[model samples]
Target chain A: MPWGKQETKPRLSPETIDYALAKAVADGDIVNLRQLFAPASPLRAWSPENIYSPKYAYLLPPSEQEGERLFQEALALVRDPDIAEHARAQLEKDGPPQLHAALVMTLADNAVRLGKFGAAAQAYEWLRVRPRMQEEFLRQGDTALDQNDIARAVAAYHAGTGLAYNYAAFPEPLPAVPDYQTRALILHADYPSTPENCVAMQDPAAFIRTALSYVFLDAETAARLDARPLEQRIAFTAAFVRRRDPDWDAFAERYRNTCTFVTAFGRRLAQDTPPAEAEDGGLAEEIEEQQATADPREIEARLLGRSIPEGEWWQYLKELAYEHPAAALFVARQSVGHGVEIVMPRLREDCPLVEPLGLDVTRTSRP
Target chain B: MNDAGYVDYFAALELTAEAKQGEVRKNYRKMMKDLLLSIGRERLTEEKRDRLLLDMARLNAAFYILRDNERRARYVEDRRRVIALEEEWRGLAETGGAGAEEARRQFDRAMRDFLTTYMEDLVLEAGRDRECVEASNWDRAHERHAGRVLRHDRHRHYQKILERLPFHEVTAPRVNWEERARVVDAILTEATR
Candidate 1:
């Protein structure tokens, strides 16, 4: 229990294993994934056009001179903490600069995952200093509420409302998303919530610290998202949804590298199963339950198809974020590498037209 | 920075203009003599003399404006018509830019809080290098820090909600609105102490 870089422990469940792999990439544990998948052919096609690229490794420089040059640039960046600070300062002095904010946050977040705590703190600290629309919101809230513009009012109300539930209720670690209510208004920075808009971040810790990230009225959204994840996903379905130009068939039929699997350890999970075809892993159990209970076809018809009207999927996500902040946090918090796999592959069965456009229905069987 | 002395140089001269030109010249001379006499004592250093010369120039400019009754009367009327109108542009610029800079400052403050909390347990490795006893106690501490981070992060996010507003720094602790009024006196006593 003395914590000085003890050997990594055996993963608890297949789900945990998937969580680890996803986390490896998210945490920038690129070499760890390579070690995990060392036996597999590295150059294999994750898709027809692309190789199964890993996040950790890069092409070795042709000359040591080139390597040294790259090293020096990184060294310069690291040797001075104020580089980021000054960059952020310039961004504030300038326009609504998105690139610096996103890049700094990502870089610092990635750095933390790579075990650079102090640097990460500085980066996060920098983002805290920018202008947000909360004051205009307080002034605007009265008019918005009076005007009967629910979206506008909701946006304003969140800026001024002093609800205390945000950090008082839930304590952390039991659930990935903690539950809490705000002592002040919940933020809505990216106001005019278009489909493309990034949701103004809420303090997940307010929920997590208070244990508010868990406990859902609907148990389905209660499914905890592993912050440290294993696996990769780029759903054709999501691409379809995200598309400004609504092209359905083009998305489903497309197949890309949106799948991940475990290496040698993954096959061991199947050992517990009677046969390769038998669905006995913990994942199978949940899928079986979901299939038996919540029909995918119905969910697709009601949620995704053209019938239920505009922002249907978007609304579902909002409701999920509202009723189950943790679940929303789970999705919100998802790193580029980790998340759930298709037990039933509802996107394929429901949106068959989309499948032909190249749906990467890669069943991430534990390697 | 020292724009204050230039005030009403011409107008003041006009206000007392009805006196004869000879008397006016005498009054101006007397005023200059007094002004010079007031600052006459010096270290006799060249740098000190130059500093006095700037002051002398400003007085001369004021007298030049005031010596003519017509111009002085116009200046006097102008002063009455407006309050501190000379430095209005600088004041406005400072107000606008400072407001903008302040919002940016607050946003950065909130961002740090978010990063600290979101990456808390992960970066800190809650169980590692942490001094404690008992698994349950460790768990509780982790949870406490973890939750605190989140709460702080939420505060950061709310800051973003208010990001565009002129930042009114609430240095006072969160107390009832009634208690807020007493804050100034409390602060004043502490400042003196």
Candidate 2:
């Protein structure tokens, strides 16, 4: 009989599992590392009393678990003043984990030199904590809520607010789509689309089903991610500036504008552009220039006009309507008379139908 | 070999329409053994022999149908839809064109695939080709069954004649015609029944 199933089994201490996992990782045993970090690991939920000791150098791998939870906590530990001294002392012998770690470590040092406290905090924290966080965070529930636990997204929407990271393991959605294709999915909530995040999108059904998964994420992100293919979402977001008010020459103003973030504390963060590098990129535009344009009706209607992701804009608009009914009517109207003028035709891969859409309208609307 | 004239040969032989060529040989061998055992070797009147012969012929027909995969496949498919069609025709004066067309198409497709797999043709010419050779094989089987029964009767008749001669009387041979009367009566009874 299985041990857990036994009625008279002894209660296992959560700390014992944590120590074993730490020791296993320290021993450079991948098999033991996997078992220690398995789905039902006893160590996962426990908060660490002393996490950033360099003795715990085994905790250095962040990109593995899709930047999910346990790893995020490991990120916070390196920033803890209590453990920083110990971690630095051990780094002398063990060295940092790898080159990426070295670069991030150097980057954090650069942040300290520049005296950008928030940036330096995140940079230093990522160097110390994120590696550990990545070491053991992939096996939360089969799926992560974009950010909100299912308990929240359920209150407002039934369809996509919560997505199953692996649908075969957890199946739910309207259009009954799986959550694999989704990313940074909820409002401030995020579902990273690392190759690991969407292990199931490997199936063809996920292409459309996951593309349809925005049934519950916020309108901007849903509008941002839905209707477009993955490669296209990247290109579209490449030009995306999350903020609007900052000037390139001014750091104080830019930092003030750029400072709004939702997920983690500075020390817990990693991967994004450092403050120094971002200074050259300029802060995201603050004022709504698109809203300020000479034509407001033209802009509103033209918004959903060019197709969101790929194939037909009408179809994507329909998915948008299905995903966010509260926003769909307004978005759907954009696909109406707003065809040629505001369409970002340059986004052809995502908006394959814009040219065909214009020609369709020209051919039909010529009465 | 129980071929009540009203019943079809395949049904009389207790065979499904889908029975394949090899299955026919398997089923027929067991069936022939049972029938001959039940009837027993006996001298029979001509009428009794004629009835048995007719029954044997029908059995032969059933074996032919089962021996060819193509015919059997079509027979199985047609038999399934035939009931649905007859019921529809009986229930309404007008057969809906679409429904009829669909059923017809399904039947046509199944038959074509079956024929292509087994006989390579649907027409009567298909029966004449390799399938005819198949039918003749079963016909030879029936003749063989009749021959065996005839030989058994002669053997029993001679044994009965020898037993009647007494050991003390040299060359004693009974002239009583009733000596084999029982074997003859048994055959006649089976014919009328």
Candidate 3:
């Protein structure tokens, strides 16, 4: 209906419908072709001389039936490698740009509908590279989701981004859908890990604070954990972190060194010295000297010794763990004395105690 | 207090008509307790006991009548009509028209009919109230429980009505018929808006 003028005399003629169907197939107007070839319509009898003309040569169904029926047949054919291969070859020898794009999109959509996700994903990849077909990619993505195909869905949604500016303007624009990026991150991977994918972890400090929430603790023991004495809490967290670490030996030292560097670097960065002046002055030299000479253990001790308010130290440690699991584990090991195992024995070893903190600890580790 | 035998139930409960439902129940409970305590401490001379019983019966009757929203609304409407009728009679008498006496007689007949109908309702209401009070007392004795009291819904209705009044007039003690009608009109206007 949005395509306009269903009753236009010239557009409604059988000849016009045939031309239009071909044009629609050529133009990637799958929606229009669907409407034109609806059941009980004369256009349903029209056949175009394209990749869809031959029975085995077709990528899509060539029968003079309704569009949906044609689509169903096409979806079935897409599952057959020989038929699919024939269709792709015909599409490559395209007479019209519209036909080529339309055939590609139809194949992708049919592939998605038929639960052929790999084929759908490949077709969608091809469609995305073509001109002005971002919305088609989005449609394919949504179709993929309807079939419960997550990989293609993530690919499609990710492709739709940065293409919003190409669409027509609205009078009263709505707020952009929230959690699109988050959804992509979730579907693309198990959780936010890399810096580019994990938008929430851009701020290492904030990410650390959120990681300290009761989400990480067992629901039944969360209240008791909160009530524990500070020393006990530290010891409990240390054991929790170590047990969770996949490679505690490699992580422990790296974490400690990174935290020390982050703290000292943050301190030096916060100083009022301007960049130009700092380059010429001893400030840069002093920071470099400290970075080289300061024992991470002493820095960790000094940080822990400071009168951090109750509950804040755990939060700081949790945040550190999220951004740098090793750092958090190292801090935990140092605080509670590594010998004590605080968590229950029955807890699943494979299950992560906390969500991936999605922070880039390596960036801060660099001098 | 008006000619319609419509006593201010709010006044009987020792409250302003604007009192909230919670306030009404709290004050009603306090009043009932105080009345019962006073009656209990007194020497049970037959005459004194009969008088205390009558007072307790009146308190119970007033509470029952006021607590029910539909009955209270009907009572308020009747009171307003009685005031209107009285004003009409006074105006007719001042003119001293030929049919003024006939009009006055018709008005008295109407009042009698209204009173008869209301009296029947009052008798039934009083009987229901006595049963309710007895049942409540029995329950309290057996369960050692203070039963939940029904709250007057009219307080919310009255508050909403008051909100329609002019800002300065909303808290005023007295509101005339014209001001009240205007407030109703304001409510209608706001609802349409």
- Best model per DockQ: 1
lDDT score of model 1?
A: 0.32
Q: All models: lDDT?
A: 0.32, 0.32, 0.39
**What is the C-alpha lDDT profile of model 3 across B35-74, one tens digit per residue?**
7788768888645654455445445555666667776677
CA shift of B12, model 3, Å: 0.5
Q: What share of the true interface contacts does each candidate keep?
A: 0.02, 0.00, 0.00
Residue B14 of candidate 3: its Cα lDDT?
Answer: 85
DockQ (Cα-based) per candidate?
0.02, 0.01, 0.01
Give, for candidate 1 chain A, the lowest lDDT window spanning 10 residues.
A333-342
Residue pair clashes in candidate 3: A26-A98, A26-A99, A27-A98, A208-A319, A255-A326, A255-A327
Model 1 residue runs over 4 Å out of place are A1-132, A146-302, A306-367, B1-131, B140-193
lDDT of 3 by residue, A219-301 (tens): 22233334434433333343434433435544433433445454555544323332233344344345456667643234433
lDDT ranking from best candidate downward: 3, 1, 2
Model 2 ranges off by over 4 Å: A1-326, A333-367, B1-193
